[model samples]
Structure formats: structure tokens, C-alpha cells
Target: MQAVWKLSKYIKPYILFAIIAPVMMVIEVSMDLLQPTILQHIIDDGIAQTDTSYIVKMFGLMIATSVIGLIGGIGCSIYASRTAVNFSTDLRQDLYETITYFSNSSKDKFTLGKLVTNLTSDMEMLQRALTMLLKVFVRGPMMFIGAIVIVFITARELFPILLVVVPILAFCMYYFTALSGKLFHKVQKVVDMVNTKVQENLAGIRVIKAYNRKNHQIEQFTEVNTQLMKRSMAADQIIGVLAPLTMFVVNLGIVAALWMGAIKVDNNTLQVGVILAFINYLMMVMQGLMSSSMVLVQLARAIPSAGRIVEVLEENTDLTSPLKPEIKQIQGSISFENVSFSYLKETESVLKNISFHVNAGETVGIIGMTGSGKSTLVKMIPRLFDPDSGSVKIDGVPIGSYSLEHLRQSIGFSPQKATLFSKTIADNLRYGKSDATSEDIVQALQSANAKEFVDKLDAGTEHLLTQGATNLSGGQKQRLAMARSFIRKPSILILDDVTSAVDSISEKTIQRAIEEQFSDATKVIVSSKISSIRHADQILVMDDGKIAAQGTHEQLLQESILYQEMAKTQAEKGVTLSE
Candidate 1:
């Protein structure tokens, strides 16, 4: 119900339509009631009294009322349908905008499948609900009340029967609503599980096939499918019982009305025409009840969906820019002061009491084994996540003090995994600097040692990379990623194991190009291989989550036992130690 209230802004324009639709429906119901009155007149006044002119006149008026009701009903339906579709469109747009505002931390709370379901299936449910609200919400109530009024006018004695039947029908509707609401909630949860399973299987299809686990994958899918079936059947079973129960109640009311009407006619207290009209009114009232009950079932399903959508829209962003801050130009000098960070407050810190400084034009290398938190340590410089304690500063200002857009623009990051989208090579590189020129792109490609491959392609920079860049080799994708970062020409650059897949010769070529082209830019290199960062001006050796040693390559090898052992191991593996 709160979710519906929040959506009122979207439906405000349709308030007039909502009003007019119900009014037209009431008019239609009144016209329907008049049909029995016309029949009464034809029997008692015109046909019975044998006056042909009276019958003809009453018949003409009946035709006119029917035509007017038809026109009004058609007009109401057209307007209501248009309003509902527009409301759904606006709601979808708002949902999309809310999703775009979610931070990386907030995004991790929901899966891709769940988000897709909220955007698609959940939205569809809301759309259907709006349609039903427009049609049944108005028509149901008007017909029920209108029929009741006509029945009272026909015979006041019959009113007592309605009191009993109406209350019973209402109680039955209430009970079914409570039952169906709980079942529908379970159904939505099962839908989310099914969506998650399908998404995981499709994304990991290659892994499944490589492990020869196709049968296991099928079994896993079957389990989720079975659960979904069970939930759906439970909901349907409830609905099945409700429909028959409602029909049974309406039929009983019809029998009661017929029995009482016979007694009244026999006692000379009621006319046959009045009895006939009362039965027609009774049937209309039952139909209205049935339609109203169906609306409740739809609401039961959509209410949970609306709650899910509202949950996302109402989430607070974990990362946000300063309300008002001065913009400062970057100078490439970065410092970390006792920086300690954790993904969760209750968990241990990933980086423990770390402190370092890199001056402009200096190349600082971070060498560590896997899971040493090298990437996490560098991510703070761009303010991707605030440290739990301590601070990161760039050019004499705390990173958090600057606007997020300005802070990130000062630094370029190339992640460990080389990712490319389904776009042209030029388009991907332009993502680094939206306004970069063609010459800037070429120079960046040369710096990454990717120009050779780019020149060989038929479309050169225009050649499109498909989704995930599946057609490209590992080394090629890494080079393209590097080229994208290089195009930014930022004051600071962070390369996270970018050359892991390249051969030693190509790695050396890329390293030389970086030194030549970006000699004035501060660089932070994270790599597991000793050879990769041996030439760095300063090397930080990390163990676990702490910096075990920090100094120039030669100084560390002489002073730190861990550095010495790592170099020795690499030398034994035939890795060159040349400078």
C-alpha cells in the first residue's frame, strides 16, 4: 500500500481519467438497471393494458439509453487503457534512474538476475495491476452498489436476504485475500531463485563444459525448476478453491431470492415483473463481486513486486561527492597515511596501517604474492572506497574532500582483468578521455604496444569488439585495456598486472614505451612476477595485508629476507634479472 502511495506522482496526471472512468461506469450501470424497468412497463402498462402506443414509446427510450451507455463504456475503456500504459512507462523510467544511482557497494547487494527481474517481470506485474485497477476497480463497485439500489426499489422485504449473502461473500473474499497474499509472496521469491540460477548457468557455461559437469548443471537447474513449480501450484490451488467458493455463494443467493420471490407473488404482495427485475439485479451484484475478488488476487501478486522495486529506489548511496567543494588541479603526488581499509566493519582490514608517498615523475612498484591486497591498496587513491581508518591524499588534499568526478579524473586505472565492451576500438579508447583526438589515440596505442595489431585489422580503429571481446586473445585484450588507460594522460596511473599474459619480449617493449611516453607521470605497478617491477625506483614488498619491506629493488633484496628469497626463486626459474 505504501508502494502504491509512492507511485502517486506518476499517476497524478491520470486522476481525471480515474474519476471519469468510474462516473461513466456508474452511468452504464444505471442504464442497465433501466432495462428491467422498461420491461416492467411493457408488461404492466403497455402490453397488459393493450396500449400499442405506450409500448412503442417505452421501447424507443430503452434503445436510446442502451446506445448512450455503449458509447460511454467504450470511451471510458479507451481512456483508462491509455492512462495505465503511460503510468507503467513512467514507472519503468524512474526505476531505471534509481538503478543508475546505485554505488558499487550497493550493486553488490543485488545480483544481475535479480535486477533484471525487477526491471522486467516485476514491472510487468505492476503494469497488469494498473490495467486491472482502471477496468475492474471502478466497474466492480459501481455495478454492485447500483444493483443493490435497484433491488431495494423493487422490494424492501427482499433486502434482508442481501444482508446475509453480502456479508458472507465479503468474509469469504477477505479470507481468500489473506491466503493468496502469502502464497504470492512465496511465488515471487521462487521466481528470483529461478532467475539467479539461469543467469549463473549461462555465464558459467564454459566452466561447466570444461569440467564435464553438464549433468550436474542440469540437475541443479531441475531442482530450482521443481521449487518454482511447487510454489506456483500452491498459489494456483488457493485461487482454484476461491473461484468455486465464490460461485457456490452466488448460486445460493440466487436460490434464496427465487424461493422468497415465489412466496411474495403467491401472497399477492409482489408482481411477476418486479420479481424478474430483482433476479436480474441479483445477477449483476454477483458479477460485480466476482470481478472485485479477481482484482484482489492481482493486487496480492503485484504488492510484493512493488515492494521490491521500492526497496531499490529507496536505498542510500554509500559513495557520494562532497556537497560543495573547491576543484583543484592534480600534480601526480600521492600519499597514504596510516591507511587501513575493510570491506565490512566487522571484518579484518584488507590493508593494515599502510603508509607511503610517491612524488611526481616517480615510478613506484608493488610486488606481492596472490591475495596480498595490492589492488585494494591502490584503489583507495582514486577514492573507489573510503578507508575504514586513516586517509589517502593527492596533491595536499584528502581524496574524500574532492568531488568524486574530479578525483577520479586525475587518475587512470587498468584492472587485473582486461575488459572490453561491444564497441569499436576507437570507441573503447575514447572512454578514457571522451574528447581525445585521433592522434591521441594512436600515441596511446603505441605506448601500450598495441599499434601493430590495430594496423593489421581491416577496419583498424573502427573494428568492433563483440561482447566481452571474445574474439581477441588474452594478450591483445590486455594491450587494448592498457591503451584505453594511456589515452587519459592522467597525472597518476595504476596498472594492475596488465602484462601478465604477454611474452617477455612484448612485456619489455611495453615497459620501455611506458618509461618513454609517460616519464613525467607517477605510476603504481602491481605484479606478482619479480621481473616486472625490478626496475622501479621504489619497490614495496607486501605479505598478507601488510608491507613487509619498502625500498629500491636492490636495497630491498639486500635488506629484506622475503625480497631476497623471491628474487632467488625467479632467477632459478630462468627469469632474467637484467636492468
Candidate 2:
């Protein structure tokens, strides 16, 4: 609940709506309070006196007040909805923006499922609670206080009954609210777990089916979902008891008021009309208590959600652009000086004391077995994950000295996975350069050896791809990813195993095209196949997390055992040694 209060600033933009809702609710509650007094007058002054005209006039007055209250209630509901919806919209937007700015390391701290739940379910809880608070929060206390004041003046003796009822209701409300808050927090955690399992199952549906693990996934989902259900039921049961307990206490107060009021009426000391009005006011007080409890329950649920949202909102991303970036231009040169990094500090470094330099216009090949830190080395160029120690520089400037946007804009990176969105072929190709012309798209696709197959489609570049481009073959997707980077015409291009899925002929064609098209661009190609990198200006053979050898293909064959062994292994596998 404290966390919920911290987010009240989000309501500032909708302050007008917030103000209007409570004000309207006050009007509605005022009318409600006035009704019991009006009914008292109708009974005592009109009906008891046998004045039909007075009765008609009083009934008409009651109808008019009812209409006014109805209007007020409607206004409150409309404005409250607007306030909650618009507030959540802005908050959700800011939360999403904050998440987008998170670096790879920061993102690793939260699961994809948890992030999605925060953006959706947690946000919805806050929105609903806000709406309830705006309406019921104002109405409840007004009804309670207004009814109490009226009862004290009209029927002072019956006020003692409220003394006992109010305190008892308050205690029950407080106790149940505290108990449910802890239970609801547990329920929300299980909901996050359930969502996580669902997300994993869906994202890896293909793999699950291929491996025949569908039953195992189903069992995992059921286990988490059952836990969610049980927690939800436990929280609801506590909240459920609250309403009945409140009603029971209110009904008991009503009975006590009736018994005492009948005695006073028979004794000719208290008016029957006044006793009826006192009972109505008592019910109004009870209504107020119920509304107050409802509001507290909503706050309890929203408290956990608000805390989760605030956690992300207040997170200080480890990666940020320098206040004043020193590097204004990039000439494609890259240098890593005595760099060492690990995903976790307790773990061994993924890249250990790595030092290298790539001049503008040079092609550097990085060859390593799996788990050799090949991908981690290239990722630092774009600052996806900053090095744990030492400095990586572009040109002569430290990478941190360049603004993140400017530095990344100067380089094009195609990862091994080749992620493509569900959009037209042209849309994905133009992702790197939004304003690319049709000819520019064609040239890039041609360079990546992808245009031939794309041209065969009836829609050609306008062809719509399915999500992850699953409709296309792996080789085709890889080529398109290369084309996306090529369209950028970046000063630095890093391709990690982009040609792995393509056939030998396509690989050679793509390699030749890259050399011819971006002759002056600094390119680092990571490949397992020796033939893919055999003709590079420099070749780095990575062993463990260190560069075991670095030289041109001919020089490495003569001097480096690792390079000679790699070449020999490829030769045995029927890969050509001659270029």
C-alpha cells in the first residue's frame, strides 16, 4: 500500500478527472444522506397528518433528489474510468520505455515472462484499484460520517449502538485486510510463475513437439497453474469472510436499534418517524463500512503490483551514454586492450586478457569451437554487454566516450540467431535504413546472395513473413539478416556465423559480395568453417577465452600449430585449402 501511494504522482496529469470523480461522489452521497431525513418528514408531517398534497410534494422532492444523485453517480463513474485508463496508459508507456533502455546485462536480471506480467497483469491491478479508490474512497467516509452526525442529532440514544458496531466492524476490517494482503502477494507470485511456464511452452512449442516433451510441458504448466488457483482461493476466502462478518454485525446493530426504538415509541418519548430515519442512517453507516473494506482489499492487491512496477521504474541501468560524448565520428577501427569479462563475477571470465586491433578496411576472421567466447567478443563493439574490466575502443576513443546511439548507428551487427519480425520482406530489409529505396534493398539482398530466391516469390520484396520468419528456410533467414545489416552501409559490420545455414556455393558468393561491396568497412566475421574465413586479411584462432594465434591464412599455416591443425582437419573433411 505504501508503494501504491508512491505512484500517486502519475495521477497528476489526470488531476482534473480525479478531482471531478470524488466531487461527484460527494454530491451522490450527500443526496443519499438527505433521503432518510426527507423520508422522516414525509412520514411525520404528511402521512401521519393525513395531508395527501404534502405526501405528494415530499415524494416528488424525493424523486428529484434521486435523479440528481443518479446524475452525480454517473458522472463519478465516467470520470473515474477516464482517470484510471489514462493513468495506466501513461504509466505503462513509461515502464515499457524504461525496459527498452535496459542493457543486455540488466535484462538478464528479469525473465521475459516476469517482464510481460509486470507490463500487463500488474499494471491492470493498479488501474482497477485506482478507479475504486477514486470513487469508493470518497463515498464511504462521507456516508459514514454524515449518517453518524445525523443519528447523533435526531436519535442520540441509538448512537451508543453505533459505538459498539463501528468499532467491531473496524477491527474485523483491519484484521482481514492485513491477513489478505500477505495472501494476495503470494497469489501474485504464483501468477508470475504460471505466466512464465506458459511463455516458455509457447516460445519453444516447436522444440517441445520435436522432442516429444509435450506431456512434460503440460504437467509443468498444470503444477504451476494449480498453485495459482490455490493461492487465489485462499486470498478470496479471507476477503469473502470480511463481507459476511460486516453484514452480520450491521444486522445485529439494526436489531438492537429496533428493540430500543419500539420501547421509546411505546413510551411516547421518541417519534416513530425519527426511529425509522435512525435505522436508515444506521444502514447507511453499514454501507460505508462495506465500501471502506472493499477499498482496503483493493489496495492490498495493488500494493504488490505497485512495488513490482516501481522496481523496474527505479532501476538504474548499468549502461548509459556519457553525459558528454567525446567521439563524434567513427572510422571503423576497433581495439580491445587487456579486456576481461564474465557474465557473473563468481564465474570464470568469458574473455580473458583479450587484446586486438582491426584497422579500417580490413577483414578479420574469428574461428573458435563452441563456448569459446567468440560471440561475447564481437558484442562489446555495440556495447550490448560492457566488459567487466579493461577498455574497448572505436578508432582512438574509448567505446564509452561515444554516445550509445551514435556508436551503435556506425556499426551493423547480425547475430547468429537471425531474429526477423512478422513484417513484409521489404520492411525487414529496410529495418536498418528506414528510408532505403527499392534499388538499395535489391543491391543489399543481391550482395547477401538472397535476391535470387526473393525475386521468385509472386510478391517479391512485398512478401509478408510469419513471426520469426518461420515460413522461410534457415539459410534464407540468415541471408535476409545479412541484407538488413548491408542496407545500413555501416562503417563496421560484424557477422557471427551468418553463413552457417547457407550451402558452400552461397557462402562463397556472399563472402565475395561482402568483400566487393564494403571494401573499406572494417568487418569481423566469426565462423567455424575454415573455408568461410580462409581468405581474410587476418585470422584469429580462439582457444578457451584467449586468442591462440593471429595471422593471415598463409602465415598462420607456416607458423601456428592450431591454424595448421584446423586447416588440416578441414582438408580431411574435403574443404578446399586453395583459394
Candidate 3:
């Protein structure tokens, strides 16, 4: 209910259509209820009088009223659909935008599959609920009450049967619905599991095939698919029971009504026409109750989805910008002051008391083993994760003081994973600068050593890359990612092992290009290869989340035992390092 209440904001824009839909539904219900009364008049007045002209007139009137009812139903459906569409579309758009602003903590809160479910399946269920609220929800109660009113007017003696039967029916409805409601949340959770399995399988299909795990993936999917079916059936089983339970109760009332009415007819106290109308009213009441239960069943299923959506909507963003942010002009200087961080709040820190400072336009290199927090250190500069203890300042201003947009725009960061979108080469490059000219793109490509291969392609800059840039070679993808950063021409550039997959020749080409083309920009490079950082202005060797050594190439080789061992190991492998 809270989720529905939160969703009501979306209905405000489409209020006219929302209002019109229910009014039209009421008109339809009223018209349908009037038919039983008209039938009574026709049977009692026209047929009983043996007047053919009167019977014909009554039939014509019935058809005309029936046509009007049909029109009202059609209007109701059309308008309800309009409101539902607008509501779902707006809510989905807003949900997606809300997800985009999620911080590191918020990202950790929901899995990709669950997030996808909330945006798609959950929103869809709420939309269906909205339509039901207008059509079945509004129509059912009105039909029930209207039927009761008609029976009271036409055959007051028969009303006692309803008193006996309605309670029994209501009890059945409550029992079944309560049992079904228990399974709704379980169904949604199982659906999330299925989605997660499918997502993992599709994304890792290459690895699955390489390892001959197709059978294993199939078995995994089967388990989740079976679980979903079992839970869905458990929930629907109660609704299935409600149908026959209500029918039995309503039919019993009909039999009782006929028995009593026949006794009255024999005594000349009741007409057959009135008795017929009374039985019809009882059946209508049964239908109304059944229809309402079906809507409630849908409501049961949608409630969990609503709650999940509300969970997402109400989640607090872990990272928030200050009300008054400083917008300073930056000069590429960088510093880390006693900074410490961990992915989890109470866990062991990944970067411990890290502190460093580099003047404007200086190129600093970070070299370390796999788990030494090399990537995590440079990430602080862009404020990807705020340090737990100390401040990371850019141009002497704490990075947090700047707006997220300005802070990110000031730095060009090429992450470890060289992600590329499914778009033309030119379009992907323009992500750095939406209005980048052809000359700007060409310069960036050449700087990243990607120009020669790109020119060889048939479309040149217009060549299309598939998702993850799977169509391109590892070297090509890395070069393209580097090119994207170069396109920005930012004051600060952080390349986190962006050239690891490239060949030695290409690696040297990239290293040389960055040193030459981006000399004015402060360059921070995190790599495992000593050759990649040996010529850097300053090399910081990290070991176990701490800076083990920092010095120039010659000074580090002489004084740092770690640097000596690394250089010795590379020499034994006969690997070339830049002199």
C-alpha cells in the first residue's frame, strides 16, 4: 500500500484519464445491473399479459440499453489503458535515473538481476494493478451492492438467503487470499534468482564453453526455473480454491431461493418472474464476489513488487554533495594526506595511511603486486570512493569540496576494464567531449597508437563496435579506451594498467605517446610492469596497501631492495625495459 501511495505521484499528470476510467467503469456496471430488473418487467408485464406488441417493445429497449453498456465498457478499457501506460512509463524512467545516482554502498545493496527486476517486472506488475483498480476493483463492489438493492426492491422475502450465503463466501475469500499472500514475496525472490542465473550464463558463455560447462549451466537454470514454477503454483493454488468455493456457496443460495419461492408461488404470494429475477441477482452477487477475489489475488502478487520498488525509491544515496560546493579552477596538482579506505566499513583497510603529493604536470608511476591496492589509490583522486580517514586534495582543495560532475570532468580515468559501448567508433570517442571535432578525435587516436588500425577499417571513424568491444582485439580495445581519455585533454589523467593486454611494441608506443602528448597533464599510471613506469618522474612501489618505496628509477634501483629484486627478475626473463 505504501508503494502504491508513493506511485500516486505518477498518476497526477494523468489524473484526468484516471478519473474518467473509473467513472466509465461505474456506468458500465450500472447498465449491466439494470438488465435483470428490465428482464423481470418484460416477463411479468409483457409476456404474462399475452401482448406481442408489448414484448417486442421491451426487447428493443433491452437491446438499446445493452448497446450503451457495451460502449461504456469499451470506453472504460481504452481510458484505463491510457492511464496505465503513462503511469508505468514515467515510473520506469524515474527508477532508472534514481539508480544512476547510487553510490558505492547503494550499488552494493542490490544485485544487477534484482535491479533489472524492479525496473521491468516489478513496474509491470504495478501497472497491471492500476488497471485492475479501475476496472475489476471499481466494478465488483458496485455490482454486489447494486444486486442487493434490486433484490430488496423486487423480492424482499428472498434477501435472507444472501445474509446466510455472503458471510460463508467472505470467509472463503479471506482464507484463500491469506494463504496465497504468504507465497507472493517468495515468488518475486525466486524470479530474481532465475534472472541472476540467466544473466551470469549469458555474460560468461565464453568461459562456460571453454570449460565445457554447458551441462552445468543448464542444470543450474533448470533448478531456478523449477523453483519459480513451484512457488508460482503454490500462490495460485489458493485462488484456484476460491473459485469453486464461491460457486458452491452461491449455488446453494439459488437452490434455497427456488425452494422457498415455489412454496410462495403455490400460495399466490410470489410470481415466477420475481423469483427468476431474484435468482439472477444472487448469481450476480456471486460473480461480483469472485471478481473481487481475483483482483485481490492480483493485488497479493503485486504487493511484494510494490514493496521492492519502494525499497529502491526510498534508498538513501550514500554519497551526497554539499549544499554549497566550491568550483575552483584546477592546475593538475595532486595530493593524498593520511588517506585510508576499505570496501566495508569495519573491514581491514585496502589502502593504509597513504600520503603523496605531486606538482602540476608531473608524471608519477605506481607499481605493485596484484593485491597491493594500486588501482584503489588512484581511484581516490577522482573520489570514486571517499577515503575513510584523510582528504585527497586537487590543487590544494579537498576533492569532496568540488561537485561530482566538475570533479570527474577534470580527470580522465581509464579503468582496468576497458569498457566500450555498442556504437560507432566516432560516437564512443565523443563520450569524453560530445562536441569533439574530427581533428580532435584523430589526434586522440594517433596519440593512443590506434590511428593506423582504425584507418585500415572500411568505415574509419564510423566503424561500429559491438558491446564490450568484443569484435576488436584486446590491444585495439585498450587503445580505444586510452583514446577516449585522451579526447578529453584533461588536466589530470589516471591510467590503471590500460596497456597490459597490448603487445610490447604497442605498449612502448602508448607509454611514449602519453609522455610526449600529455606532458602538460599530471599523469598517474598504475601498472605491474617496471618497464611501463621506469622512466616516470617518480616511481612509488606499493606492497600490502602501503607505499614500500618512492624514488627516481636510478635512486629506487640503488636504495630499494623491492625495486632491485623486480628489476633483477625482469632481467632474468630477458624482457626489455626503456632506458
- Top candidate when judged by TM-score against the true structure: 2
Across residues 275-300, which tens digit of lDDT does each residue of candidate 3 receive? 89898889888888877877887888
Point out the worst 10-residue segment of candidate 2 by lDDT. 103-112
Residue pairs in candidate 3 whose N, alpha carbon or C atoms collide under 3 angstroms: none
Q: Cα-based RMSD of the predictions, in order?
A: 3.2, 1.7, 1.9
Write one digit per residue (lDDT tens) for candidate 2, span 309-341. Answer: 998888899789999997667989989999898
Off by over 4 Å in 3: none
- The Cα RMSD in angstroms, rounded to one decimal, for candidate 3 relative to the true structure is 1.9
lDDT for model 2, please.
0.91
Q: Poorest 10 consecutive residues of model 1 by lDDT? A: 21-30
Model 3, position 108: C-alpha lDDT score: 70
Which residue pairs clash within candidate 2? none
Please give the distance, in angstroms, between residue 105's alpha carbon in candidate 1 and its true position after superposition: 3.7
Among the numbered candidates, top lDDT falls to 2
lDDT of 1 by residue, 1-579 (tens): 998778767888878877776677667767877888788778778877999999999999999989988977887787677777888888889888878767667777877677888999898888888777877877787788888887787667787778878888878877887898899899888888889889899878889999999999999989989988998898889878877887788788778877998998899887777766776777777778777877888888899889888888888877678888648788888889999988877888889999998898799999887888898998888877788889888887888788888888878899899989999999999999999999999999998989999999999999999988988999999999999999998889899999999888888988998898889889999987878888898999998889999999889878999989888888999887775
After TM-score superposition, what is the CA distance of residue 573 in candidate 2 from its true location, in Å?
3.2
